[model samples]
Target: MPELPEVETTKTSLLSLLEQTVLNVEVRQSSLRWPIPDDIQKLRGQKLRKLTRRSKYILAEFEHDSMLWHLGMSGSFRLCDHYTELRKHDHLIIQFEDIELRYHDPRRFGCILWLDQNSQSKLIDTLGPEPLSEAFNAEYLFQKFKKKNVAAKVAIMDNHIVVGVGNIYATESLFNLGIHPAQPASSLSFQQIEQLVVEVKRILKQAIDLGGSTLRDYSNAMGENGYFQQTLLAYGRAGEMCVNCETTLENLKLGQRASVFCPECQPLKKVKIAPQKAIKGSKA
Candidate 1:
């Protein structure tokens, strides 16, 4: 699935649509993760004012409302000339005066939905703080981790705890901070949490700068593959020598997602807890 960086790159690539009026919309397949809004024709005359992203969803802002777009498992958008040939999975097309935007998705897990200008979506409203935002600092993560006993990898990937830390980025971030992916979330110290915050932001920003990881079907609007996959130190380097210490990296399933780490670099260390003392006046 397209993660935060990929979604951001896609949004950036569509800037040309700004201030462009929609001439027509063609929905070759209305059935996606959710059905394309039946009344989408209401956008025919609306001009696209801006584009923004939250987590992995792209918001195409217009005069009266916005459209939320998701690049699901294998979804992508492409800019094309009006006479360009449509491929098999070309599910949606929006025509403009000079160009057309096409959406292609093999898995059909992506969505395009309409949102009223003043209305808030429960889906967007419930998402946790953006990982790169000031609200997701080490202090914020430490508080959230204190109440969860799940693996650190699982905790970081939780959309309710922090948005856009997908499996690839989670594994890489943990490895970068020398934290084992399977370590319990509550085991982290303030120092470790601080390091984790730094590494997550660093890795995510680097990925976005490189156009995101093109491990599979991900691409920007111009159909360009991301270069970050070429620089991956962990995540899919299983059984390979670690670049830092030359130890063979291992792979395992954490929360049903593939996780990779260097054993020597990220040794698992359980936090020691003091035994509870019996209360003076209460029964033992």
Candidate 2:
């Protein structure tokens, strides 16, 4: 899935479409995460006024309403001239006077939805604060972590706690802070939480500056792969030497997601295990 940086890069790549009128809207495949709204045809002749992103969703504002786009797993958008040939997975195409915007998703998990200017979406309404926003500072995260016993990694990855801190960024952020991925959320002190918040913002901003991690199928609207993957420290470097301590990095499953960490750098408090009762005469 395209995370915050990828979405932001896509938004930046789409500035050319601003103020351009939609000459036509074509949906070669109407079925996606949600069906392409039948009313999308109503966008024909409407001018695209602006393009912005909230979390992982792209918001395209027009004269009367806005459209929300999500680049699900393996989804991407490309801008091409009208003469460019379409590929197998180019599901939707919006034509402008001189260029075209094509949405391609081999996995069909992305969505394009129409939103009225005055209304809000249930999907967008419940999301937590944007990670880059002032609202997501260390003090704010500390308060939110109060009484939450979930793992720190899971807590940060929760969309309700903070948006756009996905698995890759979350793992890298925790590793940067020298916090064990499995450490309980409420166990973090105020100072640790502050460090975490800073590292999260730093990692995300750096990734955005580099376009984003192109681990798989991610690309900007220009079809260019992000270079941030080259600088990654821990996300996918399991069994490799840790940059800080030179210890072999270890991998584990946390909440079913792969987490990599350096045991020497991120040692956790040992949890006590109860002694097991001996079964009567077998092994003895």
Top candidate on lDDT is 1
- Backbone clashes in candidate 1 total 0
In terms of TM-score, how similar is model 1 to the real structure? 0.93
Each candidate structure's count of clashing pairs: 0, 0
Alpha-carbon runs more than 4 Å astray in model 1: 116-119, 272-284
Alpha-carbon lDDT, every model: 0.91, 0.90
The top-ranked prediction according to TM-score is 1
| Model 2 CA lDDT for position 41 | 89
lDDT of 2 at 55: 77
**Model 2 stretches astray by more than 4 angstroms:** 117-119, 270-284
